[model samples]
Target: MNSSFGIKHIAQFILFVALQILLVDNLVLFGTGFCFIYVAFLLFLPIGISRMWLLILGFITGFTVDVFYDTIGIHAAASVLLAFLRPLVLNLLTPRDGYDTNDSVNIHVMGWRWFLAYALMLILLHHTAVFFLEKISLQDAWYTLAKILLSTLFTTTVMVILQLLFFSPKRERVDYR
Candidate 1:
């Protein structure tokens, strides 16, 4: 990647992580839903990013949150799982025309419907891992399931809003041939 691209991602990493720690962490709805907005950073990465780098970034992002939230390795594990599954998910959602290397997974680039599906799948998996790992008891299966579903909805909604508010729409590239 170019230096500017690397710099941009670094800035994004800091911004997302900081926002998660400072603002989104406390956003719990009805005591069952928790918004983990940091996952948006990993989800919105360039489409053609290497799997190794994606996994590494995911781990770092989640581990940083784990360090702050004192949740041990729950976040790290969930993030890694999300990263590992990301490419597969992209393939599953790939249009017949396929994706541009520079494209990002956002509402503007992929449309709201596609972005919603992508976010919902990844966030659900991430939340499942997180809640299951945090509370490994089948005794409260219903409660845990509710938490996962609610958290996924909350996180996905916040991600969509953030994309609309902060991220610019995809610019059409013109060829002057």
Candidate 2:
């Protein structure tokens, strides 16, 4: 990681970890589902970010969440999976040439459709991996799948709202150049 980017990355990761564990953890809606805003921290990494760095962030994010929940390696594995597939997801949705260095993956800049599809796909992948890893022994795939989908939908909603309010590109278009 570039030294400057490393600082920002760590700050974002810590903020997300704290937010997810402290606030969102208690904001459970249905008994079975809750929002996890932390993953978006990883999701919002710049398009040009190194693949390795993104994976590292994913590992840290997942591992932190796992530590809070007392699961063994569920978060780590799922996070790595999500991080690995992130580039693939971006490629599939927007393509490499389509994204600018400053362009965001959030709802506003990418439009409702691209943003929704991108977030939905990754959330599904991450949640499914985590949910199933946690349930490795039981193997009740249906129940696990349901939990993943439900929780992801809720979490993705929070992500969209946050994107709209905080990181949306509509506010400032100042050129970095």
Candidate 3:
């Protein structure tokens, strides 16, 4: 990353993680769903970032949240998993025209349907990893599933709203080269 981009990402990382730890993490919906907006930091990372760096950053991000949440490794594990899966997910969802390396993963850039689908898949996976790891047993399988679903929905919804309110589409026209 260039100096300016690195600084921008660092600032975003601090902001998202802080908001997650201080606010969203505490706001559990119906005592089950937790809003993990911090994942957006991972989601919005520049396309084609190295997998190794993504994983390392994911772990660090998750570890930071784990420290605040008192759940060691759970967040780290989920974050790493999400990071590992991100490229694969992007590939799977790639349009015939392909994504611009400079483009961000936001509704404005990708369109609402694509953004929703992408965010839903990642959020569900992330939430499932988290709730299941926290539970660590099938004793409350139904409850775990419910928590995963609800949190996934809640997180995805918040992400869409954030994109709508905060992110603007890239203005440069794609060349389709």
Candidate 4:
């Protein structure tokens, strides 16, 4: 919203879009359709960001992907849901002290295992929701579930890889005051 944050937001969003469109989008592993790293953008936002900002960021990120992939509103819907769920999930996962205003949702802070759990949870939720909704027009339950599960799994793997590859965000250790 402010000038400084505006720059960071644009940079981050562009990086997410680029990584997703240029890097992750091309990757397919063993014919499994493995990767959708763009989902990470929704999950990695700072904690305590306002609801309106979250939605706006979600819409921007999702719409960018939609523009590139021509997937209608599927990415937009899934990204928004993930963004909405992120704060709640982070709150539950964080300790009593809580994260800082500009803290990151990353393995360095959350621990690799917990980060993986968080990433997997968001990715699965987004992919499953989007995939299922998209498939609803033509596919039955089992078929939809299959598509969702496989796509979710593949996308999640790619998202995790990209998260680790780029962000390893530094965590600050604080001595209790």
Q: Is candidate 1 or candidate 2 better by lDDT?
A: 1
lDDT of 2 by residue, 1-177 (tens): 356656766787888889988888898656767677888887887777778877887887888898998888787888889889989998898754577766546566678888888889988988887777777756687777668878998998888888878784762222333
What TM-scores do the predictions have?
0.95, 0.86, 0.94, 0.80
Query: Against the unseen true structure, what C-alpha lDDT does each candidate score?
Result: 0.90, 0.78, 0.87, 0.73
Candidate 4: misplaced stretches above 4 Å?
Answer: 1-5, 30-34, 137-140, 172-177
Over 1-177, each residue of candidate 3 has an lDDT whose tens digit, in order, gives 566677778999999999998788678999988799999999988776779999999999999999998997999999999999999999999988998876767787788888888889988999999999999999999999999998999988888888888887664332213
Query: Model 3: number of clashes?
Result: 0
Error of 3 at 176 (Å): 19
lDDT of 2: 0.78
- Taking the tens digit of each residue's C-alpha lDDT, what string does model 4 give over 62-169? 888999989898788888888888777777677677677666676676677778778777787887777666776654877666656777778767666666787766
lDDT of 1 by residue, 36-122 (tens): 999989998888888999999999999999999999999999999999999999999998899887777768878888999899999
Clashing pairs in 4: none
> lDDT order of candidates, best first?
1, 3, 2, 4
Alpha-carbon shift of residue 131 in model 4 (angstroms) = 0.6
User: Which candidate has the highest lDDT of all?
Assistant: 1
In terms of lDDT, the poorest run of 10 residues in model 1 is 168-177
Could you arrange the candidates by TM-score from highest to lowest?
1, 3, 2, 4
Highest TM-score: which candidate?
1
